[model samples]
Target: MPVTSVTTDTEALTLTVVADFPVPVERLWGAFADPRKLERFWGPPGYPATFDRYELRPGGIAHYWMTSPEGERFYGRWDFSEIEEPDRIVVLDSFADAEGEIDTSVPSGRMTLLFESTATGSRLTAVSESPTLEALEQVLAMGQAEGMREAFGQLDVVLAELREYALGKGTVTEVLDDTHVRITRAFEAPRHLLWRAHTEPELMRKWLLGPGGWEMTACENDFVVGGSYRNAWAPVGDTVGEPFGFDGENLVIDPERRIVTTERMTGAPFPANVNDLSFDEDGGITLLTLIISFPDVAQRDMVLATGMTTGMEASYQRLESEILASV
Candidate 1:
């Protein structure tokens, strides 16, 4: 759900990032206010960050080091300039060394995080400004964009678990019928935004990968009655194997209301699958009811036996952090 978008303005020497989250302004603010939580997703997926200093106001400094999978560590620090509660924060960011000294020889950027309250959730836009065009290019060349994207996806997972724990509600899953698999989950985001998350291919791709190390390389959705769609995904690392694929036909589409679709794993051993999804909105939350069907009870049980619910639940939980939450 760490779906982050970065736009570089060459003329202005800034890297602008915009993201959405389905939580209250204060909750989202906590991610930065708490050093422990910030380290959870501050670095890229394979690199876990450790913090030494934590500060939340002007003239304060925050320092951290990100350890790579191979045990190599990289340091970074931020000097806060301004802090507006549940609103915005501005800071000067720079690279650092093992001793926690800022690397002035390297590029430095001024970063700003802007927050806004929405009908269903909150929006955050981050701007990183480099002193020169060359410095901006240096940061981009260092894979900042891709790193931020991956880091945010991991952030999505963390936010969901944190919310559940804070609310004293463990993620609950229920089976409504034998042939019909029903899953109900509530989101802080509005119904319309949640509907777009289900319908839009770009948005859907972010949270569709149920677990880590899997990437949706291809997602093509026609988004209309009788239209066909295809999704392809596979192990992200050096796994030498062809990706798996799923192609389906849209049986019905009623924008923000309902959708029925038929799905089949390209080379799977089971029969095709059918699904009916309904969206209901009350107050500011959207309740998604998913009912899946199979050819028969045997096939339905077989699908369940394959441990589908666990992955589906993970995906839905991540969806809460991805959808309009990251818009």
Candidate 2:
């Protein structure tokens, strides 16, 4: 079986897996709604699953154990907070002790699972939220995103075996400027809405920064050409920590049209890192184009080496959630 391809925001540690299966919406919902069916394909590939208790209702809890091929065992639990039947499942997932108690010391997050019926089939989206950006980074480093992707790939196979499954198809494409990678995704929301989420401090704090152990420190944006913007991120941990900061030079700010900014590492000040965001409306849906340009090929390589893709993906997911909530 081919491993399901996964994408992550290198900075935010967000993971997104998109796959289209041949199963109908109702059948797909059945697989997700029925605990018995869920256990059959919930764990990563090659990991056997056993459920201790499963109550799929609002405020219910699902506790299960997964044993790897090497005979290693681990426990995980999901506390369901909201269940919208065939549409959405909202829960808080975490590592748990044998007694099914959440391990508070470990990082965990709230996840919202969305199922949208499409012309071909159902479009399923799972978005997980962490308390802090560092928490997101930690989980990504632990291979959570890849593990989830593998598990979803397993689901694809299980669904296929049950019938003729049509695998979800998508591409991993990037927009670049000879050096840096800039990924772009357009949604049906207005440009002003998107801009508010990107610029407003209160709105930015929610999905822009990670968990508790971090602070924005400082953020200033002129929102005009020849103006400047600075965003500072600092670790909230006690011991020595690394601080990440970005300073930008605004080249364009066309409300409802586009905003272009050139960013650079605050203290280090590498060459220019440009981001151009444009918006267009099609019927009732809005299109957002994000173009990020780096100084040179070497700088682009350096940025990639930092693993920004997964973090950025997570940031985008958070942004999506905020956007949906606002609308």
Candidate 3:
């Protein structure tokens, strides 16, 4: 099988794929309708697939397991709306749990596949529909179009070879919102060391700032509500001309439990945003939570769009490295 044509309507966020296969219509329909057959040709090349329950009828559902080469496993389910033998299949597909429960929190959509007999062989067309334009754009930006193209191309090859046991995980989700993420990690060091890493200006600078081009010019911590702390980072090296600063008000501080709260400016001219850092000690491991609350979804999105998670992870790694060095 070869893809004869591919067209996508941006406004509608709908993709259409037309492929010509050397097989007959019945074979093409079986490739999609039969669980075992479908799994053999599903997902991209090098990815394997497994089917749990596959019911090919209206109101029925099919659950699939896809495992990536990297050992990442993802589950997906398809709710059948129409199943016309040797002709068509319409379904609502989405990410699902192992038990085939759909994850409503994530974006998913409906799709319809049509199979027709041609003089040469068979023709197949697939159309997908998203709930919203934003969701559609998000999927497109996430590289789903290219991924689907690659996966379908692999399907063609598997069908040609009549291969068995196709494997691969479903789509990968990119964090597009801050609210959808929560940071939780444990530190092997004691609570006192963790507290010093977070609080003491000298240790903070060593781990939190590292050798970044910017230097922490001012850091005052009254450690109480109405108190203030400010840090100014002026670029060094090639970034010498860049200027950045962060100022915040300490809203809460409980040193006994190692909890702190602050309203910090995000280098923007806007008012400070709320941030809460909580620490818990379990035996010797120090569990920490850094929660940054925003005024609205827009602000949250703004912070997430800046890759805050990556930055936070890097800072934590540096902190851990410094702590290990101190011991």
Question: Which model scores highest in lDDT?
Answer: 1
Better of 2 and 3 by lDDT: 2
Arrange candidates by lDDT, highest first: which order? 1, 2, 3
TM-score-sorted candidate list, best first: 1, 3, 2
TM-score, cand. 1: 0.51
What TM-score does each of the candidates earn? Answer: 0.51, 0.47, 0.48
| TM-score pick, better of 1 and 3 | 1
* lDDT, model 2, position 201: 78
lDDT of candidate 2 over 143-262, digit per residue (tens): 788777766665654454321122112112363346545354545556578777777777777677644456678778886678889988888768356888899787765566556788
Q: Where is model 2 more than 4 Å wrong at Cα?
A: 1-5, 9-13, 161-327
What would the per-residue lDDT of candidate 1 be over residues 1-327, giving only the tens digit for each residue? Answer: 535577889999988877778878787887778886787668864465778998888999998987652346799999999999989999989999877689989977899988888787877788889999999899899998778766765555445543353222323445545666655566777778888888778787888886667888889988777789999989888755568888889876656756778889888877887776766554465656566776778887877786776777677777876665566
- Residue pairs clashing, model 3: 47-167, 47-168, 48-166, 48-167, 48-168, 49-166, 49-167, 66-168, 67-168
Better candidate number, 1 or 2, judged by TM-score: 1
lDDT of 3 by residue, 1-327 (tens): 277666778787787777777778887887787675566447643344678898889999999877543335678899999988878899997889988999887688888899999998888888877888877787678666665665566455335521121112111223324543335556666767787777888877766653456566666677665677776666667864556567777655556333434455546766555665555454455556455556667777776777666656666777777664576
Candidate 1 stretches with Cα past 4 Å from truth are 2-4, 161-327
Worst 10 residues of 2 by lDDT: 162-171
What is the Cα-based TM-score of model 3?
Answer: 0.48
Winner of 1 and 3 under lDDT: 1
